[model samples]
Target chain A: MDFDIKRLGFTLLGLLIVLNWGLLMSSIMRKLGARVAKRYGIRWFQPWLDLVKNYALRSQISHGIMFYLGPVFRIGGGVGLFLFMPMIIGSELWLNYSFHGDLVLLMYFQFFGMLGMALGSGEGGHPYSAIGISRGLSQFTTIEVPMTLAIISLAIQYDTLSLIDIVKAQQGGFQNWTMWTNPVATIAGMFSLLGALSHSPFNLVKAPNEIPIGPPTEYHSTFLGVLQTNAAILHVVEAALFMNLFFGGATNWFEFILKTFFIYFWSVFVGVVFPRFRIEQSVAWFLKIPLVFGVLAIILYM
Target chain B: MSETKNNNKFENPHYAKREVTGPDGKQFIVDPIKDYFSDERPKVYEPNSIPVVEKFLNWARAESLWVLGFGTGCGSIEIPPLMTPRFDAFRFGIQSRPTPRQSNVFIISGYLAVKTLKRVIRSYEQMPSPKYVLALGSCTINGGMYFDSYNTINRLDHYIPVDVYVAGCMPRPEALLAAFNRLKELIKEGKGEKANEYAANFDWYKENQKKIIKDWNMPDYNW
Candidate 1:
């Protein structure tokens, strides 16, 4: 357990690169969506401007200390995921602090932000925050069932719990990737990714029209800017996790960007094609189709 | 002015004072107006002393005007078209936000009835400082056809500070876009300090609001 300052610096640098990439990818996706609807999209630099504007807001009101810590915990979760996730498979510098059993830790980090948001938004005392937390937690719980089942299938297939090892196992060729060798588990994992990403069809938690932007309804100013920052980092990190587990991790920055973009796009592609589901319908939908694939994945491994 | 009537019929019970038992079995008086809401007065935040920093922030603010999507009147129909392909206000960084806390621009579209004015005032106060109001339509200017009506207010600026006005019976989406551009120009010029103006004239604005609102169940300042 030797701690090195250089390693820490590289990890922080890696996080920065991922954050910028995430912002660019989001704006690009938004532009694509706008084009689809026959409308001009926001400028590519819009997200950066919004981030600045939110932080530049002169006034801020707080409900409690937890309200302040909410965004802190959320960004902590995003950073925690990055800390243990190996970005480029064969690169020693970008491997971060990933160790044996990091896969399990990554799973826990995925849900960490939501729980923190629940506590923070609950303290805000906005009724919509409560409704959103309930829906988000329930939907996220169901999403985890399929995702965890797929991971279990992968663990059984590779006989390891480390993401680095999992990525290593898939290296050499595309045929060796879990998407080919363990298609059932990949399907289950990919299906849950749509929910995990919280895009249109599964976006009831923050149903802007219905719930008035949900959990962060009361979050404003620098608080909201932090959430937006975490959102950018989290999206890319989540895609990176999937990239490592299923797509045979990247050996370089270019490969990393290309793979993560397509992985993130999978959910966005599904989102635009489908209409939203109610909380009940979404929870039930995840339990049915993705759950079945998850079970089938596990059974295949057994 | 006539004696202000206590409009008990319109008073919301949830906002009324009552006793509540906490989870620990402790009883406490709960006055929603005083206990649930922040009573702090809005303060005027002076611009940054450094010219470069202030100018940069103003530029960012101008480029990203998150409009509160609460349409007050008939001019609301004009807003939806701004999001459509024909207008597409997104390209100009004029996006709609669902909540007041996140938005800096409040569009007082069309005429403001006394009833909707209360909600508008609350939403306006809740917005963070350096906020701007884009009063749309002749309804907001002089009540348009509603000038003789018993309920609608003739001038919106009497109740809330308005930064830009788009004059029309109901301004078309193109006109609204022009108003947004004007608002952005004002913001970039560091002239969008109407939120501070409302704070400076707090008593006068509150008196004007209370004169028409009647019930006045909520606090003077919504924060």
Candidate 2:
């Protein structure tokens, strides 16, 4: 089979757009949080400035080679998810590299960054990094249970494992979307999305200003910049994936932006409203309500 | 100096050298300070050769000042308000980072006890180059009310090169914001080389620091 260079170029361009949109979305969400607290918040361009400053820092130190490869692997996971995901459904240029079994690959890509971070932060040797990694991995494991269940539900409903085909099935109108027809699975998926997003309630992984930050405690300069870059991409790509799954997939950039924003905002909204949960509390929480919803989703599909 | 009490009388067991069995049962000496820590001396990092690029970078650095969240003294009370609705320091691109490795601005808030000063020096050294120190409160200046107190040091600059001094018994958050602005101006004008200054005067700073921190068990540089 011949590789298509043109498709690769389009995907690269899509990645750039997704990255910028993710950064802007995060800034806007921060601004919203600030407004809620009756503060002016950070400037809209602050993230861009921070990225530049982090990259421009003069000195960089590493714990080991694994520490160096940590951020690389994380960005790899983010880019991999984007590569395999279909961004704008029904659009040839925005289809990315989505194929018959891309959903399974996307699920693997979702967890790839966390495992990479675990190795990297473990090498960092900061006690907090270890604590954070264990908390993150444990919470992530529970999160995956409900998320995987939801995906399995979708797979059974559609009778296909391909993300492109799933999106194709959901096309036509909003009523036809899985969110309406398969609300149970959508609910389970959205609940897990909160954990996936790692917002306020489930944000014990980083626990900034509490545990001296999490996995990236020892990361700085360019290494941190790479993590931030991946964060931006991962947020957008994950939102896009959800958009293609539950919400009707976007046919154009306008719908894509709107749907992705709302999907991303769902977590932010939940985050702003609730206080945080401790590691064990969050692990138990995922296993309880969301897990029940996940089981219910699968049973309904069956 | 009448016989100063030796704070180093007992070694910190954490930093003490000890033998440890590996996963495979082979024994090896584990000296925490020597084995775990980076012994590399701090080096002076110069700005970019191209004036334009350096100026641009300086602007970016100055615009996004990540202050270490470590609060040393009574003046720490003022820092919390900066994030409040009243001051809202985030609007100006000034934010607090939890770790030393990630932060460039270190606020020597109020008086520094000899015990705290040791940790301060460790944290200040751990921060990457192009860092700045904003000496807060009169306590950090001439020790303020703590001048006669044996516990706290009077002058902060002797241990760490300070860039901006925010004066007051306990400088209000407004004063801290003003200090931040002044720091930003200094950074943009290419005057924020305090990290390099510390490196150039590393021996002097370490000597001053060791004089106060009697139990100097950690490495010279925390990096």
Residue pairs clashing in model 2 are none
* lDDT tens per residue, model 2, A70-183: 999999999999989988877787888786346888999999999999999999999999999999999999999999999999999999888888889988878999999999
TM-score of chain A of each: 0.99, 0.98
Give the lDDT of residue A50 in candidate 1.
96
> Compared with the true structure, what per-residue lDDT tens digits does model 1 show for residues A16-56?
89989989999999888888889999999999999999999
Look at candidate 1 and give me any clashing residue pairs: none
Interface RMSD over true interface Cα atoms for each candidate: 0.6, 0.7
Runs of candidate 1 exceeding 4 Å displacement: B1-11, B21-25
Chain B TM-score of candidate 2 stands at 0.94
- Model 2 stretches with alpha carbons more than 4 Å out: B1-8
Worst 10 residues of 2 chain A by lDDT: A93-102
> Candidate 1 A-chain TM?
0.99
Q: What is the lDDT of residue A164 in candidate 1?
A: 90
